[model samples]
Target chain A: MTEVKKTYKHYVDGKFVRSESGKVYAIDLKNEKYEIPLTSKKDLRDAVTSSKAGFTKWNSLTMYNKSQILYRLSEMIEGNKESYIILLQDHGLRKNEAKNDIENSINTIIWYAGLVDKWEQLTGNLNPVAGEYFNISHQEPIGVTFTLNSNSISLDDLVKSFLPALTVGCSVINFSEKNAVIALKLSEDINNSDFPAGSLNIIAGKFENIVEDVGGHVEIKHAAIYDDISKESKTIIGEKGSESVKRISFQPPTSGLSSILPFIETKTVWHPKGK
Target chain B: MNNWEYAESIESEKIVKIEKKYGHFINGEFVSPNSKKYLDTISPSSEEVLSSISIGNEKDVDFAVNAAKEGLKQWSKTSPSERSKYLFKLARLIQERSREFAVLESLDGGKPIKESRDFDLPQVAQNFFYYAGWADKIDLAWGSEISKPYGVVGQIIPWNFPLLMLSWKVAPALATGNTVVLKPAETTPLTALLFAELCDEVGLPKGVFNLITGDGTTGSELVNHKDIKKIAFTGSTSVGKYIQKSLAGRDVGLTLELGGKAANIVYNDAALDEAVEGVVNGIFFNQGHVCCAGSRLLVQEDIHDIFISKLEKRMQTLRVGNPLDKNTDIGAINSKDQLDKITNLVNEGVSDGGELFQIECELPKNGFWFKPSLFTGVQANYKIATEEIFGPVLTTLTFRTPDEAVEIANNTEYGLSAGIWTEKGSKILWTADRLDAGVIWANTFNKFDPASPFGGYKESGFGREGGRHGLLSYIKASS
Candidate 1:
């Protein structure tokens, strides 16, 4: 009997779809019987558009609801832990290491889910701006984030980049190259869960093809990238994103809330409440 | 154009006493610079040299840093109450001599006397008074006693809002028990020099507050000084990036309140009269040299025509003339270079097919002057819409929905401030929630208080410079 090879599509907007350019490449992992979409610049543009559309709906969700959806997504990931661990093993990880990665990934989601409601009180303030006006400031999501990270990143590190942004109500167009299948499987779990469509998009392809377009996209408020890119690439990102002043940060070993805080902008609203 | 002209209401320039030449203020007194080079500080309104200021070089900066390092030893050991008392005395003295400072600010910075008197002077005094009380009570600033002041801060201020920016940087650093080596912007060093006099009157500890006078070279020396513990700068974004790069591998703390091209979104449901007023104040204030100036006007498409018409009519009524005039709404541009930059950008807007509108008024011929102007029909990618022109040039773009308004508003590299004008409460909250800016003014614009922390997101720069949050940049956690 001959085994059937499955072709994975880029998960964008709300559904899995083939690249607009009809480009595909065989997976680099050993013993994998699948190929992933080599997403095009147009596909990346479509993902940004979808992520922008998703931002309104996802950001409009109450913190409680977002927390609930995030919790559900984490549970789905945990439920599919065995499959994810097998995929990680096939992608050149020891079984124990793969299990740890899966566990840490799930834990990261849960950690950020718990922070969804508590972030406001922790950072927000009814500032004592000396005047006759009542001034209050709170953190708000920074719309769509375009993340270009290293393919060598662990699943835990990859998800860490998106979790804080997601918890703050931002939609993410996350790009990965080497771990394409794992990113695709995680997207499937997100799609099946209560997570809103376009809230999280996973694109797998050649990094060179879509980087400039994604970095320069006007709609993307945040861009998280690995520091491994050339100085010329950083300069290009700086020049392209100069107009709207995109908040681009090279990932540090440990981001925690520091990564999340930069992506969350403060909004102080004043009203005439004083007599 | 409105045919309403009033007699000149010039505030007397006799109130300010300009010295023939000035030296760097180090330790407790003015001293000659190690380098003999001097630059004449010129008044933009008259094109006359107000004074010759010593051009501080690398050695001058080193002298000031050494003074601050010595000052920090006793300053850090001083009782918090004593520091608070010193600030209180300084605030009172500033209030007493504010008229002199206002006249000097108008003469040196080319801002209208009315604004210098009514807005700048009061705010300068207020900043001192507000931060004065914080000196003795900094224990309550953070959650625990873990916060400790970073010693010997290097402060570099800008030409716009010269004295007020100094107060903002100086007050918080002192309140948090840190000595300062400040370099005032070259074009407007007189007010800072006068401020040094006030410091002496208050008997602030010798070497506690040192002032260096020079151009960008002097600023570079101060920033790169090895002994300087932290850097606080307010200037152009390009310079802010240079500072960031310079301090990348160093352990020095840094804070920047840089450039901004803010968005003022006026919805169809907004009160048109109030909205128009807000738009004018947001952009035209300080001749639009403000870092948080609402340079981009995003009017909802439904009421775009009416708002633009009303705004134009309002622009016509603005009196542009001598900075010393009591009724002047606009003044001379800060310098010849800044004037050229504004002219180039405005001409670019015209070439790009943007509808240019300017107040029909004759400007003074001998001075650096650019008419208060605006561009309508501006696309998002237009140079006028994207860059910080840093003059009284506003770019108007229309949008149909709140979402589109937000899209246009957030499409800039600078995010220091934004203004949302709508009568609907929920809509204000909704729009404000979506806007990516550090300060969002709903139904109001260009409103500032020393107690309100102000800074920027993204390229607008980082670190808050007012309120309790402002103290964070001056101190670090003990852990």
Candidate 2:
């Protein structure tokens, strides 16, 4: 009897769909191979439109609701840990190593899940100005973030690429290349986690195919690269992003308070103390 | 009725001695530029050439950057406490000579002496003193997560706040253990030149603080210099975007304090008298040359008539004239170029059919000037309503609801600062939370302190310039 094959597609706006371009890239695993959807510029634009709307919906929810949703992602990942470990093994890891990577990835998700509701406190403060005015400097999330995960085949790297941005109220478009099989497979649990439709998107493709569009899309707001792209790509991103003064970060911190710093804007409110 | 006028009490310019010709200050000494070209720095009020400052070319900027790079070794080697002492000493010296710097600032930058004296000079000293305390305690401020300096910094300041902007950029960079190559706006380089002298007086390590004076070309040189690890620019949005594009693909840090058309919203519940005063001060301060100046007035519809009447009455009382005059409420326009820009925008606003109200004032024949102008019945699309006039030109719009006010206030691409006036605390918080601006002033406007972080959201630019947050601008966290 022939084994039933699993189909891999892009997960965007909360549903699993093939790239609008209908193009696929082949990734050869240790013992098996799979062809996954390769995202196009048009697909990226569609993702941006969805993320922009998703930002409003996701950001409007109560902090408690958002935090629970993130925590639920961890639950979903834990429930399917065996599958993730097997998938990581198919991507060239030993069984023990794959299990360890899955365990680490789950712990990362939990860490970000706990941080979802409280990262603002660690990043903002009530500025102590010497006057009779109530001046406080708080923070707001920069919206519609595009994060590129490193090409390393580890699930932990894939999770770190988007979690910090997600933890701060920003809707993330998580893009992946060499690590697409792991990222695309993991999208199953992400779909199960109940993220607001456009809040968290996982797309797989050749980054070179849509590098220019990633930087030029005014609505993206921010482009954070965790992977080491060529100097040419970095230059292209910076040059195009300058037109809109977009916030772009390269290899930003992955843990602690600073990890979320790139995703926030500080806003200070001043009120006079008078009767 | 004749408006009440006070006798002119002109401030003395004798305290500051101006040099006929000035060169770039590099390696703790004045050095002639390799370009051998100079631009005459003028007193914008009188149109008198105060001095000729060297125009820094690529070679000159390279010299300054190289000096800063060489200085980095010693600056990095200096003990944090020792660095703190130097900054403390500079602050003390500034306080003692505050009168001198104030005179020079007004002479060079065309701001009222009352402001340059009571506001800019004091703030400059306070900034240095504030950052001095942070020199040794930076680890405590953020964390020990490897907050290390970006070895050499390039700072470009605008003409509006000349010396104060210098203090804003330089003090923090030095406190964070970075060497600086600073370029002051060509129109107002005297006070920054004077600041370089103080750096020498404090016996700071040679090459630690380098000053290169020139036009936009010079600033581009500094931004493109290979040795500059970070660039902190306070200027127009267009120029900031140009600088950002120039540094593309490079591993250089940038923080821009750019243009803003901040909305000052007055709800009906606000104390009308106090709100009127704030609205006047918000736009008229520094001839509205402030980047974060409240240029757009969003008034609650029901009270719009009453608010405009009171606002115009208060504006009529503003005294416009010489920067040196102690009682001058409005000084000369910063330059002929800026005056023309404001005039063109105002003319366009009139053509666009908005009502224009100019306070009755006689013109000073010698220098650039503009009467305090107000526009009413303005649609959001008018140039005066949307663009940053960057002068004492205020445009008024009316909104019916708090949500509508927030929508109108955030309609612009710029989000540097905003003002909200309401009697209710909950309403103030609600409006502030919804507005996209970086700084929200409730029942108040134009307030600043060393401890408060100030920057913008969206295209108004990025990165805070003051308080604990500012340290991040000069330092990078390594993993």
Candidate 3:
């Protein structure tokens, strides 16, 4: 007897729910049947709103607490690595490719989790500004970010963008057009982990709908798009989002201190350092 | 009220000579612009022509850029110690001639001499000194791998803080081993011209630092220049957007320090007197021409009446007169056009049913001047509350709760700077955390240091201009 396939739905507002349009698309992996909720533009709006609300809660946590939560999520993913490898292989990865996918995804999460509490020191400073003022700059998250990945991107590449933004305290709304099933499974791991609800919203749908909806949302401070998407779509988001000065970039950093810097802003606070 | 007025203590301007014609500084020397055009820069306090500065066109910008490109080859190759020495020399020279620069700053910029001397010139010198220290140590500054400098930086500064803004741009760019071509604002070019003389006096290498004088057209030419590797601009939001759009497809770096309508929040548990002083200094400093000035006053509803009364009484004591006067508390507006913009916006605020308050003071007739005005009982949507008036105008709004104050504060499109007044330490940190601004001054206003990273989020622009992050604006790190 065949085991029953698990149905996948859009994760929004810390809950798994069907698309508002009630549309579902099938994902066929190795002749095994899986279904993905077809998220619409309205769903993107809801996810953005939820992600913004999530940003406040997540950003309020201390760096230590955030680091703990990210670390816990990586541990959970590592504990379930065997299952993830099976999932990747079932989704079309060869044996080595599947193992490598699970391994890299776990390592990316762990790397960013370790960096969660330390990035500020790498990017911030107590500036000797030539005054009696104790001036210091601290890197702060830029609020909710909208991330998009191509249809052909591996689960590891998607995690690379999501984890860095998450590590920096920014809540993310990711639209993965090609690998929604695996992305949804990762969201389940996130929800089951110590992460607050709405912190990581995963939507499976056409890239155009999500980008267009993100264009109108002023609450989204930054958007990281994998350049695999069309240039016209990127231009549309850039032009429509220009009113709010949304930082739209196709050059997503893959590694280094800058990988997390793009997801945050620098805040300098000044007070009198008087006797 | 003071029944007797204090005697005028006008600072003498005779220490500095006014030139009839000023040429652009290029390749370590003053050269006539290729455009062959000149515009008169006048004293905002006297309406007297201080000097005629060259109005550079595209060709002139090209020449300046080319000079900077050649300068870059030498500058980028110079040892960090040599760069540090040049900047130190510039800083010391500025200090030795501080009075001259101060008088020229007051004359051409219409800031009170006390400010030009005490605040502007000192900060200018300190800025150079601070960046001078970084010249030899930039590799270890950014906390990353060794970074390389971008070539030929084009900087455009606003009129409000002419010399100080120039110091902020040039000091860091040069410290990072980049050559510069800078455009001084059309209305205030004297101090920058004076600065160029110091560069020549210091025997700085030819083509290391070039200064071109012109209007917005010249700024656009520099912004659109093909060879400039980076653009650093401090101006309005609209122009910042235009420049960002112009460089949409290019790989050149850009950092903009744009406009702001920052909100100053006063809690009921605050020290009301100090808060009032901070509010005044916040908006009235620089004739309210400061990009990060606290233009919106958000007071708790409980102390709203008492705070307004105290603030009005304080505003009344501000002396608005000749900028050269040491006794003058409020100086002339930067320009006639700026004064008109302030007048129109304040008028609109009054028409929008906001109560208007102004200090009754005698003003000089010849130059640009406006009463330090206030609009109370303002709603969140009032134009004066939302827009950057960029003059000595403050709009007062009241909120009953801390969350509401944060809501109103973050509602504006600009988030450059914010001030929080409260004795409660936790509340200060809490409010500072939520406000969208880049710089938060707790119980202080308009305080800047060369080490502080100053810029804004949203429409106020991108990239920090000071501190270690500031060096990143000029340097590119290898992956």
Candidate 4:
């Protein structure tokens, strides 16, 4: 008798719950198959609520503290490379390709870890005016982004979208790719790290239906659709997102397997130090 | 002679005078050019010298940019309400001096008085007013995050609607807290110089808005300036492509609102009277110089004859005369080079075996004029149909079905805007869905509001202006 690997339900608000829709998608790995639970609309809403609740305290943390937490997450991801490689291989990646995927995924998190303190220098500044008063500009975070992970290189793509947004202190309600078992395990690692509940939530489900449901919800401040699909699907996603007028970013085909550094507000506090 | 004929004959006797020796607007004053070199801007209407405007070289652009960089610090620090007050003041001043601005726009750009007064000036004022409300409410503009301005925007405006395009560029850039170094079209530099004087009168802070006047060299220098953070341009597709290629590997952000060969479809079920009005307004508006003007009329084959007949009759009624006239419908082409291009393209249509139908109205001999023209039996592959004529020329093609209409509509590389005229609600929605242009209009043509976002897809350009999306062009996405 052969042993089978078991799939688990999503964790939301520090609790693991089965999908309310009672639906699951099967992940095929070579000759083997496993049932991965799909998150329901209710689960998505719960995740958003969790993220929104966790945003205030996470956003209030000092940049230095946030940087340390992100660095810790990166370290954990690096330490667990073999498990991530096996998970990637299960999702159709060959051995060498899976190694590259895991390496790129961990590197993305580490890259953002390095950028934690430099964000302010890059985005915020004081202006020089011919006046008596001082002028300062800061970059601030947008709240609770609803991100869709691209089907290609699922773990790396999910990490690319998640880390930069988290590094800037914005919590994310992320919809990972349907076959992204590795991303789920990565989320578990995140939970073990100092990342609080609701700071990051991962779900897996039907791409079109679940994204549409998530897009229709009002609390999703911004949404990024991350697949190369038909024009009709783009329109459907665009119109669905207009319900809340969510800030949408359509990723073009040939978007690299690297994370984009999104702009965040970095408030600089300056006082008369000499005085 | 009839009363109208006598009035027209008398108005033709008076010659319009062109100015000389224009100055640059820098550091809150009309200052001498950094370089003494000047360019002679010719009046396209008469091929006469309109003005000798100071041509800003790289040195002038740098000076204006430095001024803007200096002002950016102080201006970005002001409270949103305080910023809103300044925009409000500028908007009121524009409205108060609307007549002067309108006349100056007509004199420099050769657009008719009615358009400059009724359409251009009012919309310019409204743009400022609309963005004024946005200044204090930028928090709402972003997705629950406070928006910050990009530093020192370099803007280049086109000659089609000089002051109107300037207002579109300036108002939104200012509202979002970015200071600007703007370069108006060299041919139509008068109105922009006058706008600088108004800024001074309104006590807008020094170095907040600087105007540099020159041709392509000046525009190129401004775009390549290392200190400038973003570039917003409205102009030809060729020039836009050049700018994009030039900035390929650089970090300078760009928002281009470029040229278009928009399609205006008229179905058999469309209201004939309204369709005729839309066709007239579509092609002849601004003498068809608009980037989003409906240059291709895709009428359903069933209603092709009737629509063209009505359009021809309506075109005959349009008054093509002096731009200063209160009743002129079509004005002179903006320049002699533009007039020659219109003539060359229309000649090509005739040589290519398409039937030419001119409006049977006589053109003035002294000014740069071309009678409004329509080409029947125009193929989708014809040069007249594919290229942007940017003149009062319409190319007519017929489509058999709604899907065919959409096929012909999306055939062009430019996708700035498209129009659909049909009484069926379902078809309107269907066509709007398929048309690849940024804006799709039903039962109307060329209607714009500051609340509505406007831009093009594909080669027509990227990025948008107006509405919440307009705010995105000036601010970095994350901040």
Candidate 5:
């Protein structure tokens, strides 16, 4: 019996679809070769549209619901651990290394799941303004984020790219390059988890192809790149992003309170206290 | 009909001592510009040249940056508690000489002495005092790793709040262990120069707080300097974008507090009389020179007629005249250019088919001025509605529902500040939650405190300017 060779399309708006340009790049691995849909400028635009509506849907849900939904991703991944290990194994990881990667990914998910309802408490505070007023400084999600994942070919590394933004109620368009195999594989579990349709769209393409579109797109509130790109690319992103005063973070922290700080806009509310 | 007049109670300028000419304050001393050029700084109220200040060229800016780099060495060596002591001393000195600073502020910046003395001066002192305590407690504010300074900082402030903006920029930069090279707005450099003297009086380490007075070219030089680790700017959105573009590909930190077109939403349930006062203060404060001014009034459709009538009546009573006059509610426009910009925008509003209503008032002859303006019958797409006029002009838009109100309020690209007026608690929460603005003032407008964080969302620019969050602007996480 022969095994079925798989073709990976971009996971967008909870649906597996090919790019509008119909272009696909190949990833040659130790055991198998997979073709990923190469996201174009038009594809990036579409992802932004979906992520905009998806942000409303995902963010409207209570933090408690968001927390459980994030926890469900861990459950789905835990149930399908062997398949992810196999996918990693195919991507040239040793069996034990694959298992450790999967474990770390699940732990990251659980940590963020528990964090969804609590990050506000850690980040925000009731400002003791020197006045007879009730003033509090809190935060809001910068909607429709585009997170460029690092080129490191590990599920945990890929997971870290989108989790910080996602946990804080921002809709993330997680773009992957060579690690699309791991990201696309993780998308299956993400789909099974109860996420709003476009909240976490996993699209695969070379970042250079869509860097300008990502920066120039006004609807995409933030463009955070975890990957170490060239100075030229950084300049292009910064220059284009400045047109809309777009928020762009380069090589942001991926594991701590600082990780999600880039994706939030602090909102301070003031009201006079009186009878 | 009632004929009313406000008696002028002039605030004496006897306390302040303005020099005939000024030089760049670098390395804790006033030095002549290597450029060998000076621009006359004028009083917009009287059209008198207050003083001649150096127009800093690249060489002058370079000298200041080098001095800041040298200052950084001593600043880094100073103990956190000792740094706190210096800030505390500065804060006390500001309070002691605040009246002089306030009078000079009105003389140069053309804001009413009422605001300068009572609001700006007090806030400036409070800001220094607030950040003074935060110097040693930086480790407790965020983790120690996040409290590391970005070394030499270049700060450019606007003309509206000269010394107050200095406190906003300098206090935290020094508190976080970063040396500063500051550029005050060309039109308003007197108060900042006076502040430089205070820095010397406190015996603050040289280069720790450098003041270079010049035009935009000086600011451009500071932004492009390779040794500057961070750039903090407070000004128009266009300039902020230009700065951001110039810093591209560089490993420098930036925090821009820019322009805004804030919405002051007046729900039907709001107390009508109080709401009118709030709406007036929202737009008319500081001649609407505030970056966070509530320039757009979003009134509920049911209360539109009554609200406008009340607002117009209230606006008419506002006294407009000399900045030194304690009774003046509005002062001269910051500059002739700013006055022209306001006049042109108001004219455009009328031609755009918006109904314009300006208060009948006697403006002083020799000064730049604009009457408090209100535009009704305004479409959301009108240039006056969409653009930041940055004057004592308010555009009114009508909304039928809470959802529509929020939609209309968040429609603009700017999200700097907003005002929500409703007697109901839930409605205020619902509206504040929906608005995209960085600062939401419920039942009050134009309120400021050092402990309250302020900035903007969207194109209004990024990073906060006050409170615990303000320290973040000057520091970087070690990770």
Candidate 6:
């Protein structure tokens, strides 16, 4: 008896389907290459639509519950550590660095998971002036972020940039780096975890052509690019992202491996104990 | 007589004596250093030794930090109103004795008398006055319910704008209740020393502000000092990187205002007359010694030919002889080393197949000076376009669309500041959003205010230096 092979499609809107555009890109992981399917523009629209629907309910959830879900995702990544290491190694990382990268990715998720309940305390509190009836301030998630991962650290950098946005309840549309086979594998791992379908979507294509379109999209509230390029590239990215006044962050030339725990805003809500 | 011969006569007329002995300012007094090593402060314009300053070795840094540590206790405890009063008094006193400060700064630092009087001395006083207002009203500036100071800040300022840079550092820090141990650049230490004297005259508490004179080693000693809670530096990006590396494992707060290769974009629809002025001010201001100066000009292809011709014609009319002259439009290069770097980069641009556009004006022979230069038909990868010349040299490139202009503008590691000139209001806003620079000028150039936030992005360095955002360098978010 002969066994039948199975192929997976993009997991979007709680279902897996072939790209509507019928586009598939081959992932080049060093000497070995495999066909990894990507989400089309139509698929992306569907994911964003689902994410918008889920956001209201997800944002209103208690911080504790949100934290619990993030922690579960971290645990799931930990369980798939061996597979992740293989994926990273295939993307040109040395054995030890690959292990470290995987560990760091998990640690990043866990760090932001803990910050879910404490953003308000870190950002600040509002003063109640003499005549004001009520005064309060809190940092809400900026909304859907379009992230461009660096080619250098395909999997780890993506995780590091994405987790913080997610911890704050912002959905992400990540543009994986060219030849990022490991990142696609990691995306599959995330899909298998309890994260709602369309909460995180991955796309692969020509960077220059696609960057402007993604940046100009009105649905994207913010964008971050991690590539090292000329000042001209930065300006184009800025201008493209300006269509929607997207909060743009360009990673400096220094290593992006530093812990971002300090930057995360923690909201701490306090009420009268006597109540 | 030729300008060179005239400059020589003027140089000979100023027969100033160079002093050899100096001391460190610790605990509100000048004290003889434990280590006797010294750095020679030379006049960039004449290459003459103006003074030999005692370099602050590690021991001196320790002494200064200890003094600041003690100063922080009482100084931070004082009411903001009291601090404001003290600063206001100091500002007035400095103004009253402006001549002495200007003369000393020009003699030691080789800046023109006009700049000393008009820019350095006045801006320093203005900084104190501006920050003085914030001292008592800081609660309004901080969005948070409570604000706290980071004690014992270590500051290192550059040579270009000695007194002004010092005020930029010390005013906000002191206003926010942080005691400072500041190290003036090796070549320019007199103005800061004079400031220390003024601090005493104003009855600022002992140890509230300490002055240390030194080069990079001394700055490193102070930055690495154990008692220092924060570091504020303004200089080259290379040094900024070193400081970042040194403070990697530690929790020390840092604010770096470093190098820039900023862009100035001109559209075909721009007001050509206003843009001509912007181009001149962009690269020629302060002899191009400013870190945020727009060193690159990206003109629209439609106007490139006409704009370059008009710009060069305007450059030729600029007076470049003497910085002390009230009519001098461009001053001498800050230092001989800086002059050499500029000429070398200009020569590289020519060698790389770009055309040079000199002003056709003569330069003084004795002092370190270079006529304003422009290079057109240069590629983005050209060394002159990519590297920071830090002198009155400008590079020109052409772009077709707004997007292309933005593409050219943001193509550098330094994102300090940029200029946009167009008649349309919407275009100005559109161009500004695309420029990666921190400060975007619309239809104007080099206009600065105490109310406006100013800083750089990427390798131009982290942190801001003006307005409410500037106060963040002195405050601790923790408490």
Best by DockQ: 2
Against the native chain B, each candidate's TM-score is 0.98, 0.99, 0.98, 0.96, 0.99, 0.94
Candidate 3, superposed: residue stretches over 4 Å from native: A1-9, A16-40, A83-94, A129-131, A150-153, A178-182, A204-216, A226-235, A273-275, B1-5
User: What count of clashes does model 6 give?
Assistant: 14
In Å, residue B255's CA in model 4 sits off its true spot by 0.6
TM-score of chain A of each: 0.93, 0.97, 0.93, 0.85, 0.97, 0.79
Score every model by TM-score: 0.78, 0.98, 0.92, 0.68, 0.98, 0.68
Error of 1 at B147 (Å): 2.7
- lDDT, candidates in the order shown: 0.85, 0.91, 0.86, 0.76, 0.93, 0.72
Candidate 4: list runs displaced more than 4 Å. A1-275, B1-6, B9-19, B144-146
Q: Fnat for model 3?
A: 0.52
Ranking by lDDT: 5, 2, 3, 1, 4, 6
Which candidate number has the best lDDT?
A: 5
Over A36-69, each residue of candidate 1 has an lDDT whose tens digit, in order, gives: 8898888888998899989988999999999988
Give DockQ for candidates 1 onward, in order: 0.21, 0.86, 0.46, 0.03, 0.83, 0.04
lDDT by residue for model 2 (A43-86), tens: 99999999999999888888889888988988988898998888
Stretches of candidate 2 off by over 4 Å are A1-4, B1-5
Model 6 RMSD, rounded to 1 decimal: 13.3
Assess candidate 4 and give its TM-score to the true structure.
0.68
Q: Is candidate 4 or candidate 5 better by TM-score?
A: 5
How many angstroms is residue B94 displaced in model 3 relative to the true structure, after the best TM-score fit?
1.4
True contacts kept of each: 0.33, 0.88, 0.52, 0.00, 0.80, 0.00
Write one digit per residue (lDDT tens) for candidate 5, span A76-195. Answer: 989999998998888878999999999999999999999999999988999988889999999899999999999786888888999999989999999999898888888888999989
